[model samples]
Target: MTVFDDGERPRGGGPWPIWGIPLVLSLCGLVMIASLSLRNSMTGGSPYAQIVKQCVFFLSGLVLMFACAFSSLRRFRRWSGLLWFIALLLLVGTLIPGLGVRVGGARRWLDLRLMRFQPLEFLLLAVPLFLADRLDRSRREGFQGFLRPTLMVTLLSILPLLFQPNLGGTILVTLICLMMHVENRGWRYPLMGGAFMVVLFVSLVMIEPYRMRRFLAFWDPWSDPMNKGFQIIQGLVAFCNGRLFGVGIGKGLQEDEYLPAAQTDYIFPAIGEEFGLAGTLFLLSLYAVWTIRAYRIYRRCSNPFLSVLTLGLTMSIIGPMFINIGGVTKLMPLTGIPLPFVSAGGSAMLFMWAKVGILMRINKISLGEGRREREPEGC
Candidate 1:
C-alpha cells in the first residue's frame, strides 16, 4: 500500500471533527430552506414541497455517498473511462433542442421526470477521477506524458461545458484540472493555467453582453441599482440588516423577495441577514476546517492515485464555495453557482455528498493500512 514515501503515516480522523461540519451545514441549510419555503406557501404552492424534495435529495445523496465510499478504488479507476464518456454525453445532451432544459436562457440541464439533472455538477466528480487515473498511470512518463492526459481531460470537459453557456462551471472545471496538475507538477502550472484561464474568461465575458454587464455589475452594483445590480444590492442590504447579531431566523426579509434567488444562489446572504455576520463566518469556518482536514488526508495518503484523488476532490468542494461567497459579497462577478452543502439544489447536494463519500473511502483505506502495519510491530 506504499504510495511513494516511507515516512510515518498520520492517523485517520475520528467522526466528530471530520463529519460535524457537513452535518451542521446541511441541517442549517435544511432549516433555512424550510424557513424560506414558508413564503412559497403564501404564494399558493405547498410550503413542505421544497423541504420534502430537499430531504429526498439528501437521502439519495447519502445513498450515493455510501455507494462511493464502499466501492474499491480499483472499481472507480476502472470506471473512469465510462464516467468520462457519460460526462461528455450528458454535457452534449443538455445542448440539444427539446432534450436540454433551458433556464434563464442557458441550457444546462436534462429534465428527468422525477427531477432535473445538471450535467455540469457531474463533471465535478467524473473529471477528477478521470484525471487521477490518467496522471497516476503517466507517473513515469515525464512532463510530456503528464501533459497529454491533462490536456486531453481538460479539453474534453471544458469544450462541452462552455457550450452549455455555464461560465461558472467552465471556470470551475478548469480550476479542478489546474489543481490536479498543481499537485503533481507544482504551483507553476497553475500560474500558467491561470493565465490561460484568464484569457478564456475575458474572451467569454467580452463575447456575451450579459456577461459583460454582470462583470461591470461586480465592480459597481449601484450604478444601475434597480436592474443589473439589484441582486447584489439586495444581498448587501440583507447583510447590513443582519449587523453583528442577526435579525433572527425566519425574521429576515430578504427571502421574502428582496434578494432574487435567495434560495439557491444567495443562500449565504439570507443566512447573514437572519443569523448575522456570525452565522456567515461560522459557515465559512466550517468550510475552512473541512478543507484543512481533507487536505491533511491528502497529505497522509500513500497511494499516488488516492493522494491525487484526494486533492482534486478537496479543490472541487472549496472552489464553488468561495466563488459563491465572493460573488454575493461583490468581490467578484456572480456566477450563479450554489454554495456547497448550503444551497438548495438537488444536483449539487447529490454530488457534494458523493465526493465526501469517496474521500471517506480513501481515508478508510489509509487508516486501515496504517493499523495493519503498526500491528505487526506491536506499536
Candidate 2:
C-alpha cells in the first residue's frame, strides 16, 4: 500500500484544489437567503437585515476558514478536549432560564447579548476532533476494547441536546459519531450502537406527543394541512410551482408568508420555487462535487487522525444538507436541520467554513508539504 510521507507535497502542488465548489455554494446561499428573507424583512424590519447579517457571518467564516487552513493540526488536536468540554458547558448553559433564549418553543441558543448561537454548532467540529483523538489512541485496542468508552462519551454529549429537544442536532451528532466510530472500529460496534440509537430515538419520539405528531405529519401531511402540516404543504407547493426552471430569483410567491422558515430550514424549497428544478439540481451537484472532493482528499491522507477527521467533517456538512432537503421535499420528516452552507444561521456557517478550512489543511498535508509536522510531544 502506498503511504503519504510528511513534508512531501501532493501530486498537485497548490493550496486550494477543491475550494471553488464551496465558494459557489456559499454565494448561492447568500443570493437565496437575500431573496427568501425579503418578505420577512419587509414586515416592520429592514429588507437588508438578513442579507447583511449573513454577509457578516460569511466574512467572519472566511477569516476562520483561512486560519484553520493554515494553522497547526497538532495544536487543534491538543485543544480538542478543552473545546469539547466548553461545548458541553455551553450546551448546558443554553438550558438555563436566563442564559438560553427560547425560540419557537425550543431552548437551543445562548443569549450572548450581541447575538445568540446554538452551542451544538461547536460540536459539529469538536465532537469529531475529540473522537479522532480518542479513537487514534485506542486503535491498537480494537473496537470491543473502546466500545464502552465511546458509548459513554457519546451519551454524555447527546443527552443535553435531547433535553434541548433539538431532534435535528441530536440526530446529526449521533450519525456523525456513528460514522466516525464505524470508520475506526469497524462495522460491528456502530451496528450495535445504531440499533440502540434507533430504539432511543423512537422512544424519545413516542414519549413526546408533538414529536409523534410530526412523524405522523410526515406520512400524510394533508391530514392536518391547516395546522401541523402547513409547512410541508407549502414546501411541496413551492417545489411543484417551480417544476422545471425556477419562477426566477426574487419572484417566488410562497416566501411571502406562505411558507414557514423560507429562509432557514425550508430554504431549499425557496430555491426550487424561484430557480426551479434545474437550479435545485445545480445546487445539489455542487454539494455532490464538494463532498466527493473531500472524500478524495481523505483517501489520500496517511495520517489516521486526519482521515477520521475528514470523514466526520464531510458527513457533518453533507448529512444536514440531505436531511434538510429531504424534509422540505417530504421525503423525510422535517428535522428542522438547516441546509448546511445554505441556511441563514451564523453559528452553522462559521463552523462549516472552519471544517472546510480543516479539509484544505488536510489536503495540503496529504500532498506532503506539511508531512514533517507531528502532534505535540504531550498531546
Best by TM-score: 2
Which lDDT tens digits does candidate 2 get at residues 182-270? 77666777788889898989999999999999999998999999998988999999999998998898889855778888888988988
Writing each residue's lDDT as its tens digit, candidate 1 over 266-353 gives 9999999999989998998899989888877876776677788888888888999989999999888998899998899899999998
Estimate every model's Cα lDDT from 0 to 1: 0.83, 0.83
How far residue 291's Cα lies from its native spot in candidate 2, in Å, is 1.0
- Model 2 root mean square deviation, Cα atoms: 3.2
Instruction: Record all residue pairs in model 2 with backbone atoms less than 3 Å apart, i.e. clashing.
Output: 6-371, 7-368, 7-371, 7-372, 8-368, 9-367, 10-367, 246-275, 246-276
Clashing pairs in 1: 3-302
The per-prediction tally of clashing pairs is 1, 9
